[model samples]
Each structure stands twice: as structure tokens, then as C-alpha cells.
Target: MNLYPVLQTADVAASARFYRVHFGFAPTFEADWYVSLRHPLAPHAEIALLDSEHPSIPDGYRERARGTLVNIEVDDVDALATRLDAAGVPVVQALRSEAFGQRHVIVRDPGGVLVDVITEIPPSAEYVAAFAPNE
Candidate 1:
């Protein structure tokens, strides 16, 4: 499966900084409101933070919040949340224990893309069975 995210943002540089400093992504190409950053350890999609000044997305882009809210599944939600907060990126959803088997935090990017940072927790036997749904 092609599990990559191509997100839309208004501030390419800001988004690039967020990904680069927080997620360890280094940019390969950078232009006005256009950039490509990749993770050295894992496969990451090329994110494009469109410039609001010269928007190519047309009018009424964020009508119903269209586009990918990239879900960043991590191992340490709390730590990451703290880092993001300290970096001045407010968390939309505080780190919470999910009913399933994970902890998650939501944050909005420069272009209003909601990023869900998830950290999986050990699943209970019942939860596992329910998810497995097999005899």
C-alpha cells in the first residue's frame, strides 16, 4: 500500500521547520511555499505547504477541511506533545489514553491540517479478540 501523505499547507517554511526539527525530516528541495522533506530512517511523503499569498488551491479550499490530516504514529506521545507545545505549536487535543490501545495528540499545522500523533499501548485480551474477530 502507498501509505504516504501529501498534505496542503499555507506556510511551507513553517511546516518544514515543524517536520524538520520535530520529526527529523531534512529538506531535499525548497522553494517559495513548496518543499520536500524526508525522514532518514523511515519513508515519509513529500509535504507541500502552499503559500497563502500565491495560493494555487483556488478559492474556498478549506471549506469542509478537505485533504489529509496526516496521522503520525509514534512511540512516545507525551514526550512529543511536550516538545510540540514547547515549540509554540499548540496541541488541538491533549495526550489522552484512547479506548483502544494507544495514546494520541492532535495538532494543527500552518495550513490547518490536523496531525494525530498516536502511541500504541498494549492491548487487552478482550480488545485484541474484538479487533481480531476470529475464532
Candidate 2:
């Protein structure tokens, strides 16, 4: 299965700029109130920047901080996090092995979106043996 992530931004224009300048992602779709951006390399990704001014935005969620908290799989989460942290990017989390066979970390973008950087790990023999215990 494929995965996608979306987040509500306090200001659509401001968020769009961050994606455009920092990530070089441009708008695939835009309106007076909303904009959806896509990375040139990741054409399938559709990260929609929700407008706070939009009529449908819930009041409660509006006050809550807007963050992505999205887990994006990479080749090496440790190296990626180090490079990002060295570049002055604040890492909300750190790389560590997870039960899902991955090491991951978190990033909070300018739009208040939290992105989780992940790298898949090979399944452990013990884990593979668990389901096949009877074998």
C-alpha cells in the first residue's frame, strides 16, 4: 500500500513559500484559500496545505498546532537526521530501531508540520521465526 500525508497551515501563502524555498516543492493545485504542492522528484506525493481561513476548518483544530508527524521512509534515517541537524534543522525525534523494522526521527517544518524520517531495517530472524514458531 502507498501512503500520503496532509497538514493544516496557519497561513497558506506562508506555508507555500516554505515548501517552495526550503524543499523546492511547487504547487500542483492552488485556489484563493488552498494549495497542494508536490516535489518534482516525488510526483506521487500530494501534500496539501490547508488554509485556516477556509470555511471548513474546525475551530478546535485551528488553535491546535499544525504539524505533519508524517513518516517518510528513507535509505538511512541516522545519516539523514545528522545532515539535517547539522544544517540547523530541529529534530523533534531521533533515529532508533522500531518494532516495525525501521529507525526513524521527526522534523517540524516551518508550517508546523512534523515529518518523521524513517529507514527500513531488515527483519530479524527472531521476528521471522515468531509467526513460524511451529515450523
Candidate 3:
């Protein structure tokens, strides 16, 4: 089974461009009211954007996502951080290395969804035992 989150936004095209330009996602399906995107290297990872006012969504539910975070793991988050800075994208959470095996930065997408860009790193010694062993 495949699962992906759909974000409701005021402008589907602008939201689509946010993912495409900043995160390297390309639209697999595009429509005036919706767009489906996938990263070329990770085809299984997908995200969809829908017009918040689109008729298909129930009237009461046609609002932008709130307090939702989408995490995208990459090979080199520091480099991506530099690129994002160059592009003038604001980083909500400054790039930092975590004890729990992640080097990440957070930014808000056009629709107000928090996007956490991460790169995996070896966990700090004190936190290493907290992770389950790989099967």
C-alpha cells in the first residue's frame, strides 16, 4: 500500500512550485485544482497539493493544513541549507545536528505546512541505545 499526504492550499500552482523548486519534486499529475509530485530519486515518496476551495473537498474541511510537518530525508542537508539560503527561503528552524541521528532544518511551505529537511547522521553515544536495532 502507498500512502501520501495531501495539502489543501489557496493556490495549487504556487504550492506545487514550492515543492518542485525547493525540494526537487516533479509533478506526476497536474491539474488546475490538484497536483501530485514525486522526487526522481525516491519515487515511492509522494506528496499532493489540492486547491482548498476545490469542490471535491467537503465545505467545512476546505482549509489549509495547520501544525502539520512533512519530513524529507536527503543526503546532505548542509548543502541543501546553503541552497535554500541562496534562494531566499526562510528556515524556521536553523540547521542543527540532533542527538537522535538527524541533521535537519525546518521551513514553511506555501500552504503553511512545516517541511523538515533532514540528513541522517550517527546518533550521539548517549542516545545510540534508544534506537531499535535494524531487522
Q: lDDT for every model?
A: 0.73, 0.68, 0.91
Task: Answer with 2 or 3, whichever has the higher lDDT.
Answer: 3
Candidate 3 segments exceeding 4 Å error: none
Please estimate how well model 3 matches the true structure, expressed as its whole-model Cα lDDT. 0.91
Task: List candidate 2 stretches off by more than 4 Å.
Answer: 1-5, 17-24, 58-61, 64-68, 129-135
lDDT of 2 by residue, 35-106 (tens): 888777744555777766566876665542453376566666777778778767677776678764678888
lDDT of 1 by residue, 20-126 (tens): 88778888778875687777775565554555555566786633235557777877999999999998886888888876787889997766778888898876665
The digit string of per-residue lDDT tens for model 3 on 91-116 reads 89999999999999998887888989
Q: How far out, in Å, is residue 14 in model 1?
A: 1.1
Name the best candidate (by lDDT).
3
TM-score of 1: 0.76
- Candidate 1, overall lDDT? 0.73
Ten contiguous residues minimizing lDDT sum, candidate 3: 37-46
Q: What's the residue-level lDDT of 86 in candidate 2?
A: 79
Two-way lDDT contest, 1 vs 3, winner: 3
